[model samples]
Target: MAPYEVLYGRKCLTPLYWTELSEKQIHGVALVRETEEKVKVIRDCLKAASDRQKPYAYLKRKEIEFQIGAKVFLKVSPWKKILRFGRKGKLSPRFIGSYEVIERIGPVAYRLALPTELERIHDVCFMCRCCDDIVLIIHM
Candidate 1:
């Protein structure tokens, strides 16, 4: 069942679709036929969107994995508003670990064996990209 149905204990009643449209209202055909045409148009739009998104998403979707004993680089960045990495933008390292992945919390989160210096910092790996993932590839 849908979330709306589960929440309200019944199917949702929207103002636009409060009552069913009869066949004789606008189109000469039955209501089902008219709705079917609308559904086809919506499906076509959704398919077009999916087709465009597939290649774009797949380009950045790296299948990166590490075994229990393997080490993965933990990202080093400013977490709080007051924290600063200084004005040297060109020299700062983006990721700071070969910190061991002690436990896999979930698909995205990992429990890293952080250094004593970073003990107060959270062990969870933030998956979102700091900058845009897209890169311009000039093929010869």
Candidate 2:
């Protein structure tokens, strides 16, 4: 268990934790607090140090080289079913199909050409470079 002060300061929680807090009112507050405390500690340590040189490291945008006709599987996130009177709807499969890369918009983001069925549902979906899960960017 973390201290109360420490539990008062986090930016975000893990994806697994979202389910745990679905029914709770003040969900993730404790985790946020803990994150804040950790940040405070880091800040204090940095202030005490005379040398304030190197900046924080972050992921740099990598150059993506892919052809327009590259066939890539677009990952999708799970849909949460609403429970009404103890009845639930079936959840759709996470990744529906492999989409052809229509165009490269940005380093990480891309414009995909999906099937007609999926096309009727969504326009463009965002691809996760790290994970296999893809999210529906927008419905067209």
The candidate that achieves the highest lDDT relative to the unseen native structure: 1
lDDT of 1 by residue, 8-117 (tens): 99878753353365554644355457667767888999999999999988897775655565566656564431253443455655555456677777776778777776
| Cα RMSD, each candidate | 12.9, 15.6
Candidate 2 C-alpha lDDT tens digits along 1-140: 44653777654565444344544575367767766777788888988663553343234634555567665556554432122112244554344345677887766667788766465444455553322464433332
Candidate 1 accuracy as lDDT: 0.61
- Give lDDT per model, in order: 0.61, 0.54
> Which residue pairs overlap in candidate 1's backbone?
none
Clashes of each: 0, 16
Regions of model 2 farther than 4 Å from truth: 1-65, 80-93, 128-140
Give the Cα error of residue 20 in candidate 2, in Å: 35
